[model samples]
Target: MSKMFWLSCCVVLATCFFQMPTISAGSRVHRVRRIVGGAPAQVPPADDPKVYLRFAGKAAQIKGVLDQPHYVFRGIRYGLKPSGKDRFQRPRQYFLEGDIDATLYPPPCLQTIPGDGRVIGSEDCLFLNVFTPDLPDGTEGLPVVIWIHGGGFRYGSASQYGVRNLVGKQLVIVPIQYRLGTLGFLSTGTPELPGNAALWDMALAVQWVRNYIGYFGGNPHRIVVMGQGSGASSALMVALSNIAKGSISAVVAMSGTAISNWAVENAPMITAREIAEYHGCPTTSAMILLKCLQNVNAEIIAEGDTILERTRLTNRGFVTGLNGMLGAAPNAEGRFDGRSLPAAIEQPPMDDMTQGNIPKIPILTGITRDETKRAVESQYQSEIIEKLKGIPNFMDQVLIKNLQNCTHINDAAKNGTKQSGGYFNLLNPLQFRNYLKIARNNFIQGLSKIAEATNDALFNLPAFLTADLWSKKGVESYLYRFDHISQNKNGFGHLFLRGLPIIGNNTAELNDTVSHGDDLAFIFEARNLDGSAMDPPPVLSEEDLKVCDEYTRIIAEFARTGKITIDKKPVEKFSGSNFIQIAKKPKANNNFRFCEMALWAGLADRLKSSTCQFLNALDTTVKSAENLFFDTVAPAQKNIGQGLADTQKAIGNTAQKINPLNLFNRKPATPKTKTN
Candidate 1:
């Protein structure tokens, strides 16, 4: 092992005991002692004492242990407690009084369980963890990476993911915990309170990093904001918000898009009030509702597990809400005070420092092979069917309609069944298959309509359109698709006719498919208590490991430099063959072109076609080829084309009419014509 790796291991092992403060100059001799069953021995002088630094009128201490040659601070507070009246308000600068305990992690924000028995969460949770090799020498500043965790919009925490492995790479890493669900997302629109408090918290954290990371060896100007899921979504918000201009240098958004349907149309005040009423509040005023909610026990708030449960039943499964509404997400109202874009203009906002635009910087965006499969397996078969039982032909009609719209129904079906086995039965297959189809179709339809809408609201049009705009502005953009599948050798035969005779093929298939969050274990390089890599062990073989390593290296490299390519080759043609194939063997030319096109074009179309007046305002811009190209061509077109191609390939020779009940063949029916 290299000196760095050995040093990192020493730091992690010793962290359980003494806290190291600083490292001394020189090559020091060391002795080792064993603690765990067969693990390596601990080096003497486990940790340096905690060090204190004062800034922004607060005194905070940094606690870390020195491994071979590095020090790390686990959890540190960068802001004040945002509880009671402080809830939903912008985070205040954390003021430290005396020697603060910087060794242990702090509690995360309040959140609720989804009735799954897993701990839901809390709102008193604005804390950040920092890891550094060693304090910087004289004038050198270490590059920093700030990671945001993902959990849709309701659940997640930094504590769940550890970064010791990445820290060993020699970069300063900080994982931040922000308020989620009702506490962090609540908005009143009153002069006293604005929505998007969670976003503001992130902004505060960034500001904190800019001001404080230097003490621990981080460069304020070299910070990279990275996240997955909602964390990715929030990172996009920061990347697009005026508040983050000049603060963040680049961003890494995993499986997230910038503009969301939920965020643009829904105002926090409307949803926050609704949630309050659901919780037994009797007022419409946000402040009053918030005040009433403050007295309610955290457990009472957590009990709203019914909301998510019901959402699982609704035709539109898991509606993204303020806490749970379609139109509830962070938008201009919170930051821009509801100002409409320039009149008669067609382009979506692009400047990061202006209005709703976040700072323009290098970005890395990608999604998993079966992004929706986990969500489907988790709720579609059981929860959705139960909810739709009373609706007239809802499953059949909706399923077929959705299938027709899917860009890769057949491929998804084949892959789904291959990965899932018999789990992709006739009844359940339609749910997953149709969902993918309709999502793409709707996105396309929405973009077309937005192009025709009047030039006022262009919210949905901005996501793909912005990507195009950014490319024009000379910003580097890279996109990726993660198609890895986790399956046992015995599981493959069940997905094809060759293995249908198996008694429990369907059940066994579901067992093999790549469900959501399955990739997380690999991405985070998680390990079990026994020190073995987590279940669904790293998919790549040695050859593939080189690729995986390269992919990771590129990600880190991009974080350091604003480019995704190391050579002069166009990013579009630079396939990620160096990374291990998450499912199949790594191939040199397998780019995510079609998928990218579909997403960009479909999203633009969704924005155009939506009945939302705000989106309708962007019609003029969508009409012009230049505008459309600027908005959709680069990002969504490639993905869309790839998705369509994949879908066609999956359907194979099946000429069966699109039937929602048929799993692989279905599409959304046009709104029924009414007889005169």
Candidate 2:
């Protein structure tokens, strides 16, 4: 949708393993042999009423530590261990037996840590955790939120986020664990090795929730699927599946979307072949590849995943993910004819979105102002510098390809040989060269502009495009820009990417820095990989706390009612490019990065009287609508209390105050007090 839709997954791969040293266990003991990954499950006293629950005709002795009025059930099995023979396949549902322990944090899915490439996590990891405020016995149940944790679809687990903030709002929060990397998404473009095992794992978790969430006081029909980074797009992918039909009521895709460039793998077969060859498996046939990989040690696959990254980087000259944010990710399955199972992603997300093939449910999607700011400066610095070494070649090879894809330029126009001066030939070739100069020069200074451009290409533009496309298709799509930076310098990105490289290492500028996944810090509690609370827990000032409360309230309200209202005003949907700027005090705004999006959309050359008249006309109308809303509609709402005489007086003066030049530059209207 956002044609230049590189999208915001830059941080998913780079920052996913920032905290690896602390997470990777030094001992080789299998996690399943113990009670849980972290401290042993604290069993409740013999007759504690709050420590028992029955569901699916079986009893579970749930373990929990009190956080005021909420109860958390940790390490609940939703599916059997996707290991050994079951590797790289759909999750097998695990039903609770007579008595089960749901007390400790489950082991995370095995994967290689980002920085040192050391492997952490376990293969026997397919579990979920539940957090609830109450266990109702009545017919009515609390709205449910199925949170899919984001690790660029490579790393992370259910225990990474705490539930105190959300569960306290009377929500039933279920964070489920799924397969990652090669084990989760390797495919050979055949039924013998169909990909998207991670997506299937997610679908099965959703099914588990729909079938048994009620036992924990949750309404299956009111489930809201939400996630950050890779999880965000994964949530949308799950909702689009026929398997998950009628299970998800709404979606909250925070930083990523179904159409984000990094959301799906384009060269799955090649990726699978490469992974197979790296692990010493023959890629002559899919069946052989699958069999050999199935028997290979899980750690070797996780370690060999870096081979995919190195090959893609040397071959493509880009370094964010091995392919797209991870070694293996979701892929379109419709290309194959004979499939043994239903496809999770039938086609590319952009195609599905363009065809209006989205779930008929309200969607809340958006991006952080500086989505990949840290990512570009940190994880991608060396690669970007290498590309900059040969600017012209890099531009011709990578940036130009991106430009062509975004503009949908034809082959003839791309060559710039056949066509004279025309709109299809990038309208003005000089302007394109000038843009490159600016980017190159800016990167020479620091990573700030590079980060900004990366954010626009990857995160900002895609989010806007997703909202625009979904809104056009009769879906209620609400968008927002999270601009608030907490006093503690805390954020989902900051927590995960902490202790890593910083662009300037200037703590004073934290108030201005908002990275991808930052908004989640305000809604969910941050925790260690083992589900233990942060030692010296993060502290928020009173002001920060208020913002946290407001942020969480907005999410809870959206789950309860599809409408999202910030302050007392209803947020306008993205059909008109309207979005709320979330801050200490939220305010509605329009035309998010309009000129920049236009430049990226290849409409810059057509901004004047040219071939793209329809787009120009639409742009003009959008400006007029902004003026009309503030000058007419907005004033009317404020003046209504002044009786008919005062309202009519305001309307009469509206015409004289109108000015096109000042339309786009106006700040939010300040309330004025009339003389008594």
Candidate 3:
């Protein structure tokens, strides 16, 4: 080694250097006495492997393990840490230096586990993990697939996903982390605290990829920005963003559309105030409150971020309420509003539904068949049906009100199904009365009724509308409805509310099955943080695995080429029913597509044409296209000022004592849905 290397090693290995007191930085160094019988001093194995790449006139040496056919780099910094002074602010592009020892994955962004408000993860967490077949070089590159994980915008991490399968030799996979919950999306519509920081963070990541991906064996020009669920929404938003214009070549949005009513927040300022004061940061001034939040610990911030959903108010004993029901998520930064603060707008609006700012790109979007089954709490099934029968004022408060709440994240179909107090509407020849009657009777009957309605209103309608919008514009768009119901022990298509699979008999009942996020198993090999596969590893039946293989083939192909297909046929047969129905092997129902189209979209023709004709008479006056609910579901307070004031009052007027410990640390009831 050179004299400079000796000096640097001496400084880094300070304790070892101290033993040799005579050693000098610029002098010839002599070895200290070694152990008895030592033939020669053996150098320690390099702590980690290193691979270097130069991009944008800068160089980085990444150290990742040999993950077989792929070179895997974990916890690669995609942007500067959005922590301390930068908390809640738009993400700043992370500058680079030195050997990027990206061997171990970084901690997840700070977020509370759902059900209980216990926090996990760190704030200094803006990293992307890359899995590539080719190492960083300056020659030709492979097509890139950048992944964004989904978690209702409140919580999720890059580490939660497995990218090995996605990073086939033909594709380079990069999964990135953005700020989540209060840390990421908190905003007051002020320039200092504009919302949609996560979106901006995603935009920043896209910029990073465009500038540096080529060095990592990824073609910067052939980047496919893909996201699932909230990530899907974010991906769409990124594509629509002014900053990311000409950055992304294509998109894959699974189970989400930015146009859906639940996608964007109308009142993040109200949520911010509630969060700040509830977490003990009492200040009317937005700047002071923000400063207080910056000083707060990430754990407290996580608890505070989730407090809104947990804290319930007695709204006349029917159902408890919170000031803000919607979790801390992406909100309008007032970029388009002419009168709003101009500085709050970080980037000009690009993918807005109403603004018609959608990007011109090849898009693939799809949804699971029973999305609302996940949206509706499984435990509430009995109570839902019970409340619909013979109970006074039950129809309004418990049923319709809860249905309204579901509209925020689910569907507004409850508005059509649920009946008001007066019997007059029932007596009259109302066009929608039969539809309402069928819905109410179904609600009275069992789970499937409300479940189906909510599914259509929330997941299906939004997905269909997104595809329709692109199709109407003559843009290349592929649509799919994932109907594969897994009956195996670890049903590939069925997971409980906590995301653990519903095994054995639970998987057998494929009636109202195939919950949300279940398709993930097909895309990746699920593994734990310790770099080992999960204990009781999530397995697919041979049947389900076959389906997984097919979907995987199609998705991987889509990532490779721009086209989406299964076998040799196009994924969607829009000429007939417009969507490809992906069920298990031996698709039994021939008219399943036409029948489902009628039920979910309320298509009169499909309803009339299919075997289920009794439901055809029920009217659907409001078109799914017309009922875009994302920006529409504001709860009373129209003005931001009023909402904030009311939110403050709600925070101040607390009758019950809050034991943050009891509320936060109390172990949740059995895991119902996936945690991430």
Please give each candidate's TM-score: 0.62, 0.75, 0.72
lDDT of 1 by residue, 105-146 (tens): 556555543334344444556778777776755444667899
Q: Runs in model 1 with CA error above 4 Å?
A: 1-44, 57-60, 66-70, 113-122, 189-192, 262-270, 305-315, 318-328, 334-358, 382-469, 487-515, 527-548, 566-676
- Candidate 3 overall Cα lDDT vs. reference? 0.58
Error of 3 at 16 (Å): 48
Q: Name model 3 segments beyond 4 Å from true.
A: 1-50, 114-117, 136-139, 312-325, 336-351, 374-377, 390-444, 489-512, 529-532, 571-577, 584-676
lDDT for position 297 in model 3: 75
Q: Can you give the lDDT of residue 601 in candidate 3?
A: 43
Candidate 1 lDDT trough over 10 residues, lowest sum: 495-504
- Kindly list the per-residue Cα lDDT of model 2 for residues 494-597, writing each as its tens digit: 55433222211223234467887667777777787778888877667687778788778878888888888866777776764578788888778876776455
RMSD of 3: 13.9
Q: List the residue pairs that clash in candidate 2.
A: 7-458, 7-459, 8-458
Candidate 2 stretches greater than 4 Å from native = 1-65, 310-326, 382-390, 393-400, 403-446, 487-494, 497-511, 603-676
